[model samples]
Target chain A: MSASDDIWILGISMTKFGKHADRDVVDLGAEAITAALADAGITMNDVGVFAAGNLMGSAGIAQQLQKQIGQTGIPAYNVSNACATGATALRTAIMAVKAGETDIGLACGVEKLAGAGLLGAGGQEKSVGHEWTPSGRYGAVGPIDGRIGTEAMPGVFAQIGMEYLHDHQYGGTAFELFARISEKNHSHSTLNPLAAYSKAMPLEQIMNDIMIAYPNTRPMCSANCDGASAAVVVSGEKLRTLSLEQQRRAVKVSASILTSDPFEQACQVLPNINTLTRNAAEQAYEQAGVGPDDLDLVELHDCFATAELVHYDNLMLCEEGGAVDFFESGAPWRDGRMPVNVSGGLQSKGHPVSATGIANIWEVCQHVRGEGGPRQIEGAKVGLAHVIGLGSACGVHILEKSGLAA
Target chain B: MSTATTIPFVDYLVLEPEPHLIAHECTGCGARYFDRRNACAGCFATEFRDVDVASDGIVRSFTIVTFAAPGVEVPFVAALVDCDGTSVRGNIVNCPPDPEHVTLGMAVRLTTVAVGADDNGVQAVNYGFEPR
Candidate 1:
């Protein structure tokens, strides 16, 4: 869609990202959706389409969510693309509006991942031992993970981080540098009251924490928690009819891009987090008509401490192989020239998987609309939100502050 | 050499002619893959040939994992080894999982390990790399 026919985010809301033992996915989903609808000053009747994202839940989260709120029976679309599920859901709604099939749309992502350990391990560790035993009809298959390197998220991201440093030869201090990146995100989380962790993690603590993988300690990993985030999108023409308050808070969707791997020779076995992310970032910049330097802030996926550093390069926030230099310059700090993950990032804000995608966009929206309180990037105009899932899907979105007057 | 009683954990690993990994090298573009592929990712070539990979490789990247799910051992070196032109993912065994023991570009050779054994006296063998 062109800039003139832009889709605007009229309202967005996120439940405080943390463990909710008492609440299920539908409970959290309904809460965020209700809050977003209220923020838009509209009811479910006004929503023309609905998209819901939940990674570890049963089928039809959108219908279940509607049952909690008002059931308008709008065309519901369920989406799940690993950690990018939320962004995928938001794009579904945005696409509906962009296609002229609807003027107003609603999207939400929710997940309950508290105490879910090591993401992809999926309780396989329980049966794992030096010698595999006959557990099922498939027979004794031992732990395939450690046996054939690792498909675990921690190991994958750790390899990706170290591989970048290896390719660049940054004076052989990958561990300390990665820890410092985690320190910045944890520090940023302190200002984000909604983050799962609001206390700043000292760099030494991050460096010394029990290592999940080399260069990535336990605290350096994204915390698994239960949370939900939702957004309301309306066509530019339809948004013009809204009240002054609604129009003032609207954030324009500059670009929405998603990408998957393009078949590289060596990256087949190892997850190529770099190529797909770079492709998405490049397309996003072209679509938005803005380079990385124009971004006032960023909320790229920091699934691991290693991930954030590489994404600096992936997002073109620095020169080729200049991620180390970018961090050294302190440009990604909360008050630095190009602030990033001011909402604690996935590292500290908590990655509820599906919730993270829209949560990242919600962070950008907060800063662009001047709604960010303590963590605000002053006079922020444009921002980017990014997330990547290892089954190999990436979503990059560019958002801008509303320029129209009531 | 593996006998009739042992089985390679993954199909790509060949146990008879020495512990080495094989790739589905695309005849069109020479792209290598461990898993079965319908077509070449690079040039969309439908034909592939079994190419035996070089046994020795350089450590392109590695991670010393200290934490994992319950029952999994810790402090193992998981590494990505570049065997000649192909990239191989496996564990670095027969050495300490530490910075002093494992560094980038360390020379290593592929080796086989007995992962598990069933009641029929058959063993499941997996491939790993060790310091050369």
Candidate 2:
């Protein structure tokens, strides 16, 4: 693609990921969008299109946000793809700009999930106290999630982690290995001031915390919090018309790819999380004309420590069946060869559902622009941001400092 | 004095004379599914036929859940059993939910459990696996 056809992220911002009891969905959305607009030195009137994503809120979130921010009367899109909702929303804006439909596009994601305990399996909302009638799909026993098997995120990811170890023949210390991964992410959180829980958790603490599942503990899971993230995207050609300062700080959108589960018999019921992510990674690398080795940093969906271990393989950061060895080598630590989740990841940075995807990208964008504060990876150039939602959607975005940019 | 009619929790579960699972096997790709699927996930074939899943299987993967949402009991063994190449997700019962009792590749058999009953004397039955 020509430089004129390329899409670039001109500005990005994310709210401190934590409990915001006084804030509602629109409040957070407006805050993120306004800040991102100011970051790019632009206003809502400059945006040709708007996209917004939210999980628990009603439809037309983009329209609602416009009422609070500024109603430019541009085409507004509301997107949701489980946890990848934010990335999907951002992609909508990028696609619009790439298609010449817009010169500047705005995207934002927001969510408020404070005090919302163990997130339920999406799709199965067991009727609470509703009299069990003998006429439905299950006859009388509702969709068996907790009763028989587990559709719960913790149990599912725990099983996914164990299955990877069992499949790879990593035994004996498999549980401890997972705990160590959590410890690394929690430690990384200490450098990230915006993280929800920036405390460094000892390995023993993570292992001894309330065991949500066999291999995963409470500390190893993503913190349920509220926050928002937004970004402004512009066509590369249009970006040249902006101020030199804005043009110099713009991050090139090297690639953006989304994938869903392909038919796999073994994990049909559980939904294969690996293949989709690998597919997205492959596509992203090919699109960016770069390999995993080129990434200076990454912010992947570490909803659970178990999920993070498998993603190392899924993201191709390690060779096939090399995830265990990769961790043992400490390559994923912040100072390691390939630092993964330098911003504490979802475990401590907090996962606000729809906001997580863009927040991850924001983390990468910050480092690429040499503005990552204390957690910055020195001279970081290329970065990858990834998020996977259990409806089986995976989004991978590769970003880099444009050659023409500072 | 009341009469209780026991019903299988899910339609695919059979409890008459013996406990077994019925899978919706795709005619095109031979893929099996415990729940009713409109089309085959593998080949997208709209044809399906019921096939009896083996009552005996080996535990492929298992997790001992120790924490759960309110009102739901924890410390249970949730396992994915592979029966004759068909994957069945269910709980492991009649044994402790720990490493000593439940293990990967352990032999198990299908068993039925009475979940609960309603005011009209209707008992709901769910399926689980037990160490053989």
Please state every model's RMSD to the true fold in angstroms. 2.8, 2.5
Over B1-132, each residue of candidate 1 has an lDDT whose tens digit, in order, gives 334578777777788966778888989989988777788889988999999999999988999888776666676788989999899899999998998889888899999888767555668888899999
**For all the predictions, what are the DockQ values?**
0.52, 0.52
Residue A194, candidate 2: C-alpha displacement in angstroms: 0.7
Which DockQ-derived CAPRI band holds candidate 2? medium
List pairs with backbone clashes in candidate 2: none
lDDT of 1: 0.87
Off by over 4 Å in 1: A1-4, A122-141, B1-3
> For every candidate, what is the interface RMSD in angstroms?
3.9, 3.0
Error of 2 at A69 (Å): 0.8
- The true-versus-predicted C-alpha distance at residue A350 of model 1, in Å, is 0.5
- For residues A1-406, could you state the per-residue lDDT of candidate 1 as single tens digits? 3323578999899999998999999999999999899988888999999999898989999999989998887899999899999989998998889898889999999999999888775324553234434333223256566666765789889998888887887685788989999999999999998999989988888888888998889989999999999999999999889998899889999899999999886787678899999999999999989999999999999999999999999999999999999999999998888898888888899999999888899899989998899778999999999999887899999999998883
Worst 10 residues of 1 chain A by lDDT: A131-140
DockQ of 1: 0.52
What TM value does chain B of candidate 2 have? 0.93
TM-score of chain A of each: 0.94, 0.95
**Taking the tens digit of each residue's C-alpha lDDT, what string does model 2 give over A222-312?**
9999999999999989888888899889999999888999888887765578999999999999999999999999888999999999999
Per-model CA lDDT versus the true structure = 0.87, 0.88
